[model samples]
Target chain A: MVSGHSSYVMKHHDLPIEVHDLTVSYQKKPVLYGVDLEIEEGSFVGILGPNGAGKSTLIKTIMNMIKPNGGYVKIFGDRPRAGIKRIGYIPQKESVDWDFPVTVFDVVLMGRYGHHGWLSRIGKEDRNKASECLEQVNMLAYADRPIGNLSGGQQQRVFLARALAQESAVYLMDEPFAGVDAVTEKTIISILQEMKKAGKTLMVVHHDLASAKEYFDQLLLLNMRKVAFGSVSEVYTHELLQKTYGGKLAVLSEMATEVAKNPEP
Target chain B: MKNWVIIFGGLLISSSFLEAKQIGSGEDLNWLTQAERFIEMKDPSIRKVALGALLMGLSCGLIGSYVVTRRLSLFGDTLSHAVLPGIAVGFIWAGEKENFSLLIGAGIAGFAGVCCLSLLKKFTKIHEDSSLGIVLSAFYALGICLLTRIQKVGYTDQSGLDSFMFGQVTSLSSGDIISLLITLLLIGLFITINFRQLLVTGFDPQFSKSIGIPNDFLQFLLWMLIAFCVISSLQLVGVILVSAMLVIPAATASLFAKRLKNYLVLSSLLGAGAGISGTFFSFLGKGLPAGPLIVLFSAFLFLVILFLRPEKGIIVCWLKARSERSRIIIENTLKATFKILEQKDFQENEITSLEIMKKRGLSRREVEREIDKLASSGFCTKNLSANDEANLPPQTVMILTPKGWEYACKIVRNHRLWELYLTNEAQYEPDHVHEDAEKIEHVLGEKTVRQIERLLKNPKLDPHGKFIPSITDIHQGNLPRPS
Candidate 1:
């Protein structure tokens, strides 16, 4: 199961991730407010929202990279820091410096850093797992090449392999499909699907609505709050989509128009 | 940087800007004549200077790699400059120029500068570059004013403070060496214990943070180390120019080293080598200072590497580009020849150079040059055809050899297959696919061609209905080989 925590007694009936009453603000702008959602195990849930709706910020808050002004996150019924060893994090592609002078193998090997003691040497098992992860992404042939030499798609695959090497039960990907070629998009989706089949909980921040409907079995619609969070069929409705995509100004204007049409009856 | 180069050039021009009186006033020692004595173990002074320089180079170069890779070269400059006030304050605080006090004071000032940079970024409307410039010049000016005030007070021991400008290698006390040893050991241990954390945090802070790595703590620790590195170097390369020591060796390493581990090792070696050579040259030149000369040598090394590094050097890249351009021209000419042959339905085995020129829209001479290139490469055979003696121009007819035909068919096949794949799989419009396929044709490998061929179900025609040379067509130009 790749359970990283040896001593923490993980609860048997807990959701993979439970974010309760989360509120985050950047300066004075409220990016996310009171966002609450529970992610089930083995569910490939896509967080869908328009730009500036705080999808990535929400994910970051769950990972504890950004602390919410209010509310909390519980992974395996534990604080994020205590339960993070079992979480595989794939950040946005734009977040990394591609010119960094590391080979594909070197990057994937970093996943084993958590497993090995801080001062202990990397063992044979770490090397085998790294290669196996690379092989899963069909990128073993490029293991020796510097990550900068690869194309955008190949670079994404290398990063995916690195996350795969972590072998965690929970995968948090932030816009993994952004800027990748079509073939790479398909390859990543298929791999994520395989991860889900093996009982991994996958949370992806996706921008494309059409592909979101096709890829994710569960959908979390967010517009500065928890607008909707449920099964794909339950959440991906015309009314909910219009509500989520509609801006606060548009919603206010629509409400006013309804009041004017009813003439205060 | 423009600012740095001009200053170094200024040092080279005005070499006498530093005082003629060196540290210790051992005039008439004839250091140039006694240069062979530099490595003699009998002289403890020489050994101390060499070891101090080596230690400075080792730590500066190793830490400088992190600075350069993290895009913090300018920050290093700012931090080094920011430490000046602290040095002056340390002199005042100790009432004497003690190495330990100066180290502590400079470290505090350097970190203060880092804090100012982050604070400016967070709270102010000032841009990052402007903030760096503001912090750098303001602190430096304040330190200079303090130094001048101290000089006006006329303390005899203040002579030691003057060495902080250009550095006096002869002033390397045994105590200074001890501090340097301790600094190097601490730096080495820190990097060793936290290599992966520093690397991931530097490359992708957000990802490292998301993975539960303490990115802020690591960054804070790195800044502390950089501060210490700058302070330790003040005795070897003064405050204003020490950042160059941190930048140049690491830059030279980046020119050739493809991995971070190699970059770190090579940077240290380059730093040490430059330091020793620069000191040796100064020793040979007698009254010359070592710090500026070391920087000049480092800059020289950087230029050499930029031009001559094996893989990505400008000269190598230029040469490769030239060869690749010529290959493209040769391939394009072959494709044109194949098109001409197809126009005649392969009924005629030879086409005149004038007709080829017309098809390629080139002048007669240009077409002849291309044809000659094709013929010399054994891709085609050219015949005089009796020169059409009555005509106004001489004409030569060219026929493709089997090797030429095979390559031509390969290019054409790749072009058409790509066009088909883009149209069918990628959903590119047929018209939009042609321009992209034109550029992609010469670069597609045989394996990709086979994959596309299989993907397209071996289609006979492209979107425009042009014949795509299939596997059968490719083998037609195959001939018996000697092997």
Candidate 2:
């Protein structure tokens, strides 16, 4: 399986994600500005930032959900739309409507949708894949349950199962650990570590500083812009964290506001 | 299962096309004859009207599932009203009451209303509900003005224009039927091809976009489908009641369906059923309007499902609550019996009804009823003890059977164990644990009880110094006897 995936990876650029000078603004308020990143193919990277420091915005911009005002993001040297097929995304739990009438199996099956034409039937292979993913997450017993009938940790596990079903080479997750139980958090981090060992690249938006340092091999400290990007041992220092979190960059925010008011062109 | 529904729906639609003899328009005909006439498919115009209603129902139900699921029901209503101006403009542009032009005009008007709503939401601080209200009323007023102007102008083909407010089924033409059929087909194909994409986007648009699903395009397409459905339905249900067709049947289906696939199928079926039955009732009553009757029928279905559905219906929930209340009462009575036995230090095998009445704080009559209930269920046995005093009524003595004794021990054990667990593990005061344990003891399962016992290290006594019945003691139905 590893050999097969490595061959698949060799078909694309070694760098799974590349962002150059990306800037994003929502309703004329800049969220991410002049951000640049290049993630290796098999590394686990954690994005650490304070509240409102554009962690989710950077992930969204990379997914092409929000168009950047300047610069561009490429996945495997292709545009976001084309490269996204190779990406699996786990969104924030609060962003979904739990009352939606879908079973756990149905949600997991949706992961395979990108692999087939929109009109194609979900074949036996797809069903088996979905069941396998559910089994991996230990949610097989809940395959027929409505999504609303789950606890917070169980819901996060279901999302993780869906991402596993996608079988993508790259993953972008937003706060998968938020509100989850301790066992679920451990289960998720272990699975992520296994995925990294299997040659899949992962970038996760994490809020817990302690776990962030222990979980990922590399860290990206963000505060409206990239403050530091290096290995955990190099960038996890008090000085860099203070720089990422401290409000000493009042001039940068003023510049953000000014940029929002006027276009570079 | 899905194919069966589709086939059944197709047969129902096709059955309306069968040829039959025309019935006479008799002013004095009774209700049964009118019903016979409706079943005959006799009049060509009646067949056309029936087909139109079915098609309208099918399309509205199909699109309304998405509308209701996405929380866009009000948007559907706003779009329905927003199409009036387009109808008026189409009438003026066509220089007559042309079905095709009217439908096109209404579609455009619905699209424009959606655009205006989105713009108001995107550019300003106005909330979605307020923006929907603005677009709904503003377009409706404009259309009303245009419609009144057309009437004042007095065109030759303007006779049936006012019927758009409240539908006139007699005005349905073959053109209208064909357009409704086209709309139904389009909606069916769109849903079939994009079911997963639509589901994901509706459930989570942000995630859908990340997976390369064109969230914006799908949203726009859904809006277009809604507009098409509303526009085609206007001739049969009119603008005022069209939104009801979109929402009512879907709401009824949502009450019982656990999956989106079932919800859509059931909704469309209910919509079709409502359409046929409403048209039938309107047929029975010579001058009754079909549109309002259809909406009323669907509303009736919603009420019926809301109260009678098998799992979560109001009546089911009420019955469940009633049973739960009785069970709690029975368990409480058993606990009271055990308390009395414990007070006697296991020396006595029987207790008097007067003692129970005292322990439970109940009247003599209520105690008699409780003992009777317990005896009937084989939980305990009651008998009149030999009365030495002839003047006083004989006192009733109750003895717990083995099952009853074991049950009472288990309840006591659960209560005592929970109280101990709460006071020790949950950090509750010893005084505060009894009230909570009172409620939880009846509902705690065996597995949870064992887990709590293990967590608390299998303590033998509660915080109040009461012996918690051991599992072995409960199994043996054992109580200490006097040496």
Candidate 3:
């Protein structure tokens, strides 16, 4: 249960993540039809919608993991790569191979590689910081454990630990709680609560409608286009939920596939 | 005399327009004699046929390790075999075996094969495995056919011809040694300058790419090195067995190492060892083939280490599993004993240890070890009212201190709560639920158990009709249930 509201002193005052008239396509069919959103700092924002809502594609475009066809996405009033150091990202856990021969310590150390640029070695200070991040996630006991041996929830925590080691100002987590145990979920929420207290912004791609109200402060209701974007209390109503996720999921999925195939538009 | 005639003849045929730098004179003859003596090791007239073989082995060992670890072993083999047609065509045109023209033709052909493979992979839907297989077999077969055509054209000496196929390690001269040395130096420089980049790219290309490392460029560089190394070592290992030279050493080293640097270094050492040992064996055994001998030695080392290494070996994994099962049984017995003590309140006298063991369905020896472990850990006290050692019935009633009872109850509570959570909340089908919950309950902490209890709204019974423990301790209560 995250329950503290601290005084928000915004130097920029504007929303940390802002997207305006964002349109994306694959080939020539539009996937995102003028989707727009705004998210504030010190907020836990859940990007909520059913499968194939272009929710993942939208985030990837915002992160510059993929180039958008036509859109404007600003993180801290700049491009995603410019603010990469300030933005920590946890990609879907399944995207990586667990059988890869690396220990928990080795994987977490890679977070600092971005900081220590190419041809530069990681220093003692970076190592100490990585250790601290591992401690925060309670994964210090398994620091030397091969990543392959860990359970699904443990692997997710290790990924989260890597992001924490980055010590970024914002976090974008894609499906952090998917296949995670209840305890691991609580651990993640508590860490997010602490980050929130420290005035860091977090955007999570979330499923599990039952816990959406309990977990999120702000919500981006998406279904290939902007359904709603506001505080969860304002945007997470039954009507908006239905619009964002219910009957529109199948139509959005078909549109997403067609759009994915037609990327040029 | 035949070797010299073939070489000079080939040289004249390729660069006939360029003047020969004054036929072998006094100074050159003296240098050649010293080189031949050094190789012979005390033989008066070019003592050792094995020296040429040794130099070839050394070059192949050094460069082959990198190729194997990078998974470019097949590429090495394909490129090696593809050089045959170049050798054949160079000989056919020059009317004699010529090193320079053959090398040029081989380089062009090898590069052509690489280009074809990459283009096919990029432009077509055919997978890389099938594509490489097609290219390797087709080019190699063409080379063999060209070799047959060249052999029939009245060139009977065939000194250079024999070296390209199965390899003529014994025929290596001082000139061949110079080429091998140059290739070694190039490979050493590559491994030194970009060691870290090569390692990271090999281990995880996606991660290297994400961190803004130019992985594609590095991959291209790596493939280029592979091509260079293959061309250099093909004379020594031959087209057919070159892949063995590349793959065996790295495969052997992986069994011995966990880190990338150690694996690379160990691979080199294994390769060098195999090369040296195979050379020695080939010398002693008269006609024993060196390439296959070296590969066999490496394979033998890998198998020995795989089955025998201390911590992570096959034998160790088996032993660890057996011990783990025994430990789990003992831990559970201790847990069951503590449970009985809490329920009975330590008031019943003359309660034999056997009674507890029978109640828990544990063996007597297991129960005894559990009691000993509990006593040693200070979880319980034993031998309080001592009497006659053997004849007097032993006071076997077990009692747990507050600390022990709390720990025991925590475990029991976690187990029951998980069973309920798995059955109801997780929607795990009933028959499959118990074993998963059983394993998970032992590892989960009180904090998680509390969270699960709250999520299930302090559920009274599991889906299987077993009662779940309620959180009683105020300090370790439940989290607020989601609305």
Best by TM-score: 2
Q: Candidate 2: which docking quality band?
A: medium
Going through the candidates in order, their DockQ values are: 0.52, 0.61, 0.14
Model number 3 iRMSD: 3.0
Better of 1 and 2 by lDDT: 2
Model 1: residues with Cα > 4 Å off, grouped in runs:
A1-13, A247-265, B1-16, B20-35, B39-42, B318-483
Q: Candidate 1 at residue B419, lDDT?
A: 92
Backbone clashes, each candidate: 0, 0, 6
The Cα error of candidate 3 at residue A179, in Å, is 2.9
Task: Report the first chain's TM-score for all candidates.
Answer: 0.87, 0.88, 0.86
CAPRI grade, predicted model 3 = incorrect
> Evaluated with lDDT, which candidate comes out highest?
2
Better of 1 and 3 by DockQ: 1
Winner by TM-score between candidate 3 and candidate 1: 1
lDDT, candidate 3, B191-262, per-residue tens: 676665665555555445445567778776666655655565555555666667667777766565555566
Query: What lDDT would each prediction earn against the true structure?
Result: 0.81, 0.84, 0.66
> Higher DockQ: candidate 2 or 3?
2
Question: What DockQ score does model 3 reach against the true complex?
Answer: 0.14
TM of chain B vs. native, candidate 1: 0.74
lDDT of 2 by residue, A46-154 (tens): 9998889999999988988888999999898988888788999999988998989889999998899889877788899999999999999899999999998999999
